[model samples]
Target: MKLEIAQSTPTAASIAMLVQEHYGLSEVVESEFLRRSFNQVYRLGLTDGRSLVARLSAERPRGAPNLQFEAAALEHWAEAGCRVSRCVPTAGGEIAIEVPLPEGPRALMLFEHLPGEFTGDTALDIEAFARGLAVLHTAGESYAGPESAYRLDLDYLLQRPLQGLLRAPTMTAELRPQFEELGERLQAAILALGELSQVLCHGDAHGSNNFIQIDAQARREAVFFDFDEAGPGCLAYELAVYPWNLHPRTVDGVLSDKAAQQWRHFISAYREARPVPDADLAAIPRFMAARQFWLLGEYAGRIPVWGSQAMPTDYLRRQVTMLRKWETLELPL
Candidate 1:
């Protein structure tokens, strides 16, 4: 189902005009393209020696919280002294604004420039990163604002994605049964684990979504951002997400030994910072499988907005291969 249409970004001139008119950031000296998979992120430099990140959503991670809900979540984190991506509100005190597009309307958002640097090609301290996730989960317990209908549950994870694969025309006939069985097996496995430890999760706490800052004392700390996917979810599932982010750099016919060690270290650190239920630890592999399937469905579902570029032809097959390897994965926990 290649639609032959790729989403286009607005010109720098248009972006400047929109920023000035809406948020009063009139000194936009530069707007550089950062990335554009789920959203279009930009580095906006101002004449006043300030930097900000502007997110122009491509609008395809559907069925999560609305802009208002996310804004509240960020506000809560800020108020609680949790390091998160700070959202810049508009004159009307709103975090998200819609800009007219030829296709329809696209959502836009802005964030204060977080003061830190990312681990570009450096080995990440998996333990330090995990501690930050524990902190995020702890802070979520204190949120008094409106709760989102969304959660990282089966509906959002397995079932919805399974349905997306069903709609994909290119989904192989041979692989269809495999995915169906996999989905059923995953569902049963999740249920067999009984109740998992539940809390508000950062949803996507992978390396790219977090940054490390060094204070005047030269102590390094991790700060998380990209709460667009934040919601109620299992602690195990939250812990499992690290591997998926790591998969790209370390993927093979099997999960590499080094990567598995990193996964172990991260989980151990989470346990050190917060008590992880035994049930959640046992469920991590299944949750990893769930993440893979959900992302496959996500890419398939985004064909309307992003077209064929979203999923490579071999993508699903590779996921199937990864699933096979999951059987042999050995965790220290």
Candidate 2:
């Protein structure tokens, strides 16, 4: 009987071979495993002292079309002069190469490695990062590419995750009802807001995905990468991600002084590049709740491949506690 495999990690040697064969980069000296989460990433070193990143997407429900959407968006953004990690086309001019593995076919795409450091605690760094995100939003507004398989809508952000939590064996009976109630309340609140400004959101805009560097004028600028979660979504939802990361895991969801300061600087800087309507600004907190739910679902959905250790019972309980705390906060953006 043939054994079933849920996932497989392709060897670094195989990745080097693929890069050389498909990308025409004969100078690749090393291919090292960078990290693994939803997707596997590798860092490739070239003989010319340049570097590249190769991302092998895990088996996504949307398959190759989804990868294509990502590629197209990156290309579009790059053309618009946004500091994005540009995708390198294969020898055949394909944006992504489909490679069959033991588990399934994963899309492999290479990108030019960007230079800069992650945003720091300083106001300048935070502001630059915020401005970069605003630029991305502005650039994405003109995207006329194929529709993304995923949408950062209520179903993807709220319902699906809530359902995943409900199905998790670790979720206690007491916690299940709480999640459902919160989910319902969040959905209702969002729906009550009616229509909102939509843009191609860098779904994971939580500061860390961006790099900050000072330009010739000594002004900090940001270059963004890791757009794995990007898609068309509400502007408020896109802005909410930064604050959600800043939110401390406390019972009373009040923003810490540092968090509040960072948020103020970020929003102020963001507004300089693009206008954020009062309605969208006000809706940010609610969208933050939705982000939490989306994350819960993402982790739960990955349990089969990642295992229970990633989302232990304690972590779930802490997340629920945070959700409850978030409900209590009166954040006025």
What TM-score do all the candidates reach, one by one? Answer: 0.90, 0.94
**Pairs that collide, model 1:** none
Give the C-alpha miss distance for residue 88 in model 2, angstroms: 0.7
Candidate 1 deviant stretches above 4 angstroms: 1-6, 119-124, 248-252, 309-314
Total clashing pairs in model 2: 0
lDDT of each: 0.76, 0.85
Best by the TM-score measure? 2
How big is the positional error of residue 120 in model 1, measured in Å on the Cα after superposition? Answer: 6.8
Instruction: Provide the clashing-pair count of each candidate structure.
Output: 0, 0
**Candidate 1 TM-score to native:** 0.90
| Clash count, candidate 1 | 0
Error of 1 at 3 (Å): 12
User: Taking the tens digit of each residue's C-alpha lDDT, what string does model 1 give over 246-317?
Assistant: 655223744566776777777777788899888988888778778887787878878876666566557767
Could you give candidate 2's per-residue lDDT for residues 190-283 as a string of tens digits?
8887788999998898998989988898988899898888899899999999988888755555788888889889989999989988888878
Per-candidate Cα RMSD to the true structure, in Å, reads 3.0, 1.8
